[model samples]
Target: MTLDVSEADHQRVSEAIAVAETGTAGEIIAITAQTSDSYHDVGLHYAVAVLFFYLGTVAAWPPLLDWTWALLMGWSAPPSERAMLTLLLGVALAKFLFVLFVMKWMPLRLALTPGATKTRRVRRRAIMLFKAAAERRTEGRTGVLIYLSMGEHRAEIVGDAAITAVTTPETWGEAMAALIADVKDGRPADGIVAAIALIGEVLAHHFPRDAADRNEIPDKLIEL
Candidate 1:
């Protein structure tokens, strides 16, 4: 998958994160993923559906069965059960392969994937990234990760333990909403900047910067 965020956009978001961090001890990290998961299970589902439909059509239409039998028998030999089963299996395999091929396109694959499954995968990926890149990196455990998965059309905000202790998850709703809106409009950089500003406001309220506070994490947009 191609990245929607460009280098210039990355720089813009990096600047926004820097500006936001200037007023608070909180560390904000923005990340965008082309996709959280391949959703191969969805492709498998389509293949299964195709197999069942092909089999069902053959079973329901006696004329189709007769045609297949004649084709297999060369119009001279009597139709045998073995020949019919072979033809059915071969056709089913071919149809399943065709379905799989069609689902290779990203749009078709995403469309076939369930919304709930996408959401779950996106959230799980966000949490994993927060742990790997943001959590425990801050001196005061005031790190927050803003993650967006483009293919799934999902966004999540994950805060470190210290930040979550003082701020509820609901507090990030506005930032998340703003980010999602901009992302949907194909302005991922704008979304990140907006989300950073909102998150900065919240962090400033709860973890205002001190004279001795130091920047602990890099303020750059990470693309995956």
Candidate 2:
């Protein structure tokens, strides 16, 4: 549960995660990630929204800034404080819409399984527990997402079920250890992901995605 991640391996680990979105957790589901600059995303959307909102303010400057401030903060403010609220209102609206639309809607549309949800929750718990335990023993995020982002010499167990799919846990652990070594030793993320996807494929061969299809896990995951 506890591990270390370093600074140099962040992108590699992130890329691996982005590509590892192929399987189901509880029953069968997919998860994915992508690199993003949220600051700019907020700024861009807010810039446009604010431009329009500001135009509305100009056309109908009926002292509605107080109401706008109330909407942003969930409380009212007097008109005397309407000077710099334009940017704030625009940014808040844009951010709320983004979270509601992209973060919320898109994931629901992905048709994730209850099993996948459980796995994700368990993954969070494991990581958090690792960090808490590490806090009892180590100095940093040895088992936290920070370590994953850092891409330290650490191997992650996706879950017990994931490991169970493999015939040999011993070999699986060894491969994971080797992967940790690879990342720590400066191997690229794509290569690391390729190695994992290959392992997933092998496991699928034995365990299979449906376990009934007798089909191989698609190789597409490796490309990610």
Query: lDDT by residue for model 1 over 43-131, one digit each (tens)?
Result: 98899998999899988885786786677666766667787788888888989999998998888899778899999999999999999
Judged by whole-model lDDT over C-alpha atoms, candidate 2 comes out at 0.39
Clashes of each: 0, 5
lDDT for each residue of candidate 2 in 161-206, tens digit (9 for 90 to 100): 3344444545555545555565555554533555555555444444
- Clash pairs, model 1 backbone: none
List TM-score per model, in order.
Answer: 0.91, 0.28
- Considering every candidate listed, which one attains the maximal lDDT? 1
Off by over 4 Å in 2: 1-152, 162-168, 210-224
lDDT for residue 47 in candidate 1, whole number 0-100: 94
